[model samples]
Target: MTGSLISPRVDYASDPARSRGRFQIEPESRTRTPFQRDRDRIIHASAFRRLKMKTQVFVAHEGDHFRTRLTHSLEVAQIARSVARTLGLDEDLAEALALAHDLGHPPFGHAGEDQLDECMEAFGGFDHNAQTLRVVTRLEQRYPTFDGLNLTFETLEGLIKHNGPVLKNGKRMQDLPQAFLDFEHLEQLDLDTYAGPEAQVAALSDDIAYNNHDIDDGLSAGLFTIEDIKDVPLVGRIFHQVQKDYPLLDRQRVISEAVRRLIGVWIEDLTAETSRRAKRLNPKSVEDVRNLNEPLVAFSEKLDAEQKELRRFLMERMYRHYKVNRKRSQAKRILKELFGLFLSEPDTLPPPWNETAQQMTKDARARVVCDYIAGMTDNYAIDEHRRLFNLDAMI
Candidate 1:
């Protein structure tokens, strides 16, 4: 794969020069394409900066070596760029989607998200994907001219619909998040269709990165041993090959080598599979890719089955392990306490948040509080809970 040359640019690859333009028009950059500017803006946003301390799988304070949201985003960008480059897609757009993917993930990984969803049930449910749309469209608050990063239509479309169209079978989505509804009122994302091919590549790149990295984290945390995972499908085969090739290799090296190979194999398979699909679909333009019913980017059936098996292994062995469950329980408590306190006693919230909460209606007030908590880092959430609830710590 390293020696393979980039294919000639395809008509279906997103063209930055021909971008649909930002919501708020400005002078074109002398040095950057529209997508490049979008990527740069996201990299500099406060939400992007906060991802450094946000939990990926393990809480940030759990260990120095664990993958935080920031590191995970970077890894996803690398994989996305490689896939984009190999397929003659726009590398910058793929990288942008990869980097911006998790900007809306709350403090303690899925645990925080789950708690937030329950707390907001009265107002509107919370979803990280919808929150990501909110972050870019309205939450970032950097520019004097715009409330959020005024990105191109392509970027916005990709970010919101990266998981395919929001609608199911030509019906309007039931219970769409308030943020998504708000954005659609402003500028419709055509949520009935799949995102362009670049977005599809970025989404698959996320799956590739998380699956492999979670294994590394789980092993390091002693949740499961390397030997315990040797019976899993695709991963198990990679491990066996690595061990047989390097009989005396240390455990750490064995895991690393096997994971590296696993990522490579997946990338190779994805590139081949996507190309095959493109040939059959004969998409005339980027729009044609979106209009198609099937996803342009996908894994082969065999690999997809194997990947599902790996997910099951991780779910039972790592996600449901007692240690992780305990952490998740504590995380839920902190978020619930914070949400309840902030809503009941809006004055307790800090200066601007207090003022902001005071000015909103009930549902809006809850949404504001939700945003504040969702933006917190794992340690910040713990510290904030301590400040609010622990007398000794407050003292």
Candidate 2:
């Protein structure tokens, strides 16, 4: 883990000791803060390690250099901690949020998620954010008395609503995801208000990490050339500046330098914007941050606009590139096929999954299939598909 970049604490930072304590209360760790322990628990979770083989933009076997979910989470955590430190928020809380944010994503990035959602359409639909909450709160089964990791309530709050409140006016704006509704009966997260400042920072930090890293990945994949993005927003300007500053620089070095600088630009803008909001709000505590109508952490309006334009360019150029589209189609088919086979003939599922399926209602069994598939890594899903469908494939 990267060392904290800044160390000035402020009144609004989430205090670890004073945190809303764990779901199943246990003795506190003598050596760690609550938030620090939250971070450690997340890092040590089984799902956290599963991230290694899960796709970010490219499949795990595609190349040695591409980012996997594990690497991406680490990058997001690094960026979040840096921003949190600069803003005098709880670095540990922000880092934990960043790391835990993507735990719900299935094997093949958005393609896998899209397919899973389609398969579960009649079964309350699949939502990664909700699945992440489920993974931590209901599925992990790490403790003797609890089903999940038994995380602190503060961590749970951020995990559930880091994007923003699930509620609007007095009720949820849309049907709440099943996992969230399940947990709601156990503990109520104020779904109408924003998360604390640390979660807010972690959310924006994700934007920074993916946007910049995608540029690098796209370049490496030959999905688009550096020149192709040279006319995009801030990204274009950075690329041109790098080329001018290092005329003889190698291709890889140029992309790396530009991506690094872009991350710095984003972090600078975010810190400035958040500081401006902090001054205006003068929030006295973490609760004050949540109760406020607007988020305390955010990018500046100008940067937000630039990022939108850049996203448009990437959508057309990299995300929709023919090669990636082909894989998306294949990934969707693989996940869809797996879901069908498992849901229709639950006995085919190995051991405990098959045993558990026997007792569930149709919809409940479908969800069990959904969870099983959603937890698979890219290669595991592919191999499972082959085993189920390919007569010549090894068992």
lDDT of 1 by residue, 1-395 (tens): 46657777899999998888887889999999999999999999999999999987788998899999999999999999999999999999999999999998999999999999999998888999999989998899999888889988988899988788887666565558776776753346677889988899999999999999999999999999989998999899899999999999999999899899999999999999999999999998898998998999999998999999999999999999999999999999999999999998998999889999988888889999999999999999999999999998884
lDDT for each candidate structure: 0.91, 0.89
Q: Where in model 1 is the C-alpha error above 4 Å?
A: 1-4, 170-174, 184-187
lDDT of 2 by residue, 1-395 (tens): 98855758999889887898876779999998888888898999999999999997777878878899999999999999998888888889999999999999999999999999999999989989999998998878777887878888878889888679878656653577776776753346777888888899889999999999999899999999987887888999999999999999999999999999999999999999989988998999999999998899988999999999989988998888898998899999999999999999999998889999978999999999998999999989999999999999957
* Residue pairs in candidate 2 whose N, alpha carbon or C atoms collide under 3 angstroms: none
How many residue pairs collide in each prediction?
0, 0
